[model samples]
Target: MRSGTAPPVPSAPARRLLLTAAEWAVLVAEWPGALPPGLSVEVPGSRQRNDAVAALVARGVLRAPVGGPVEPVPAVAADLAVLRRPLLTVRLETGGRGGRRHGWFALGADVVVVVLTLPDGGIELSLAPAAGLGAELARVVPEAAAVTGPTARGGAPPTGALPLGLLDAAPAGRGGPPPTAAEAALAGELLRRTAGSLDCLVLGRAGGPVGAGQVSWLATDGGWVGLRPHPGGSPRRVVDVVSVRPADLGTWVAPTVAALLEGRA
Candidate 1:
């Protein structure tokens, strides 16, 4: 198996159910024998199915028909139980003029799942989960969260939280001044100049500027750019920008946006 961190702890009930289910599925898939008399098999409360079989073996509900080596089912179940309450958190950051696109950051008990989404574009989710479920999910959604950026290539950016200002400055729409020719031209210029550097570009109705300051761009060679107008100013003046690269961009952008909408960011 590929090596990586452990997975987040599922709830106890969830974990138990998941383990039970895995036991049943495995029994049905492999053993195909009658369940011992008066012995009850159940799925864990969590949705994990693979763990169910492991739980059964751990519980001693199923024994090897050959009477050779007993599977270490109980030990595995205990391990799963221990992981049920693992602590984890996810963060997201959105950039560009439109705010429709974003990046994600996930910090779980043992792994992380970062994602990025571009306006009217495809989604990119990255898995950094601990062992167990997180790793299992990584296998399930390999296409959804492929790591292709600098970090995957061993050139990660400095490890630091994205500036709150950058998160706040995510665009309200496509990163254009307005429907007017000048605004469209400026927005196009920004995209043209920063092609491949920017994960997304947007232009639409701008939200009022943030706070007392007007929107501005942070200079970076290859990163993200956001645009928003100054707070309390006319929406027309609302333009914000930030810098992000195509790879690491997803790691902190999408999950943050999801968290914000969920009132967790």
Candidate 2:
């Protein structure tokens, strides 16, 4: 690939690259931020590792020619971009002396994922089902009902307005166990199905305290989405307001990120 050339976002399941643990290590070493955590990649010797890199390049999962630097193609970076494509998006905001906190959400047909930004410059990912999530959100913000709906047949994906406390809650209770294996699988499937399309909810970088309430998103058709806020009433200190909207995210994904890299700066 050329210096400024961007790779495409993989949408088809066939575009998913299945690699050995050794290959994954090589790819991660070349592009540090292009893979999710948990896999243990341990390979021996520079010769074998180099061989794996060459094989990945040959397979079109990466782009590296001779002396060129190894570059991750869509097969490596598409997961990050695809995860950001949701069926419906909801912006959750709360403020107090502890400083302002924001929760950015992407709702899919089966999964409700949230990326929360804390005052301490930390972020967290949470996952839940639409039905269970709606029940929880209503506890914090009664007007959260407007955000969630039947997502089948072009209907809007489920959306919600709730405090981070309620959202971070596990099935056991608030601040309990993280998502189980089953939940994680569902979340992964949701991302895979929504990749490279705008029919789902799309989330973008969350604004700061001094910024506007609504977050913006770019659609695949060269237009903007999420400009219109979903109808709802203000609740209270927990969830003052919520905005559920749409946007096409796959059209703008750069093929080197495994996760949303915006707002980190």
Candidate number of the best TM-score: 2
Alpha-carbon RMSD, each predicted model: 16.1, 17.8
Q: Return the TM-score for each candidate structure.
A: 0.26, 0.27
**Per-residue lDDT for 89-153 in model 2, tens only?**
55544332223445545445555554444334434444555434343232222121222222222
lDDT of 1: 0.34
In the range 1-265, model 1's lDDT, one tens digit per residue, is 9789889866332122222224444533433243222122343345455455445556664455475744434533333232232233222232333232343333444444333343444333334434333332223221111221222122222222222222333554644343555444545444444322222211111133211111223322233344434455553444434343334333333343334333422
Quote the positional error of residue 181 for candidate 1 in Å. 5.5
Scored by lDDT, model 2 comes in at 0.39
Q: By TM-score, how accurate is candidate 1?
A: 0.26
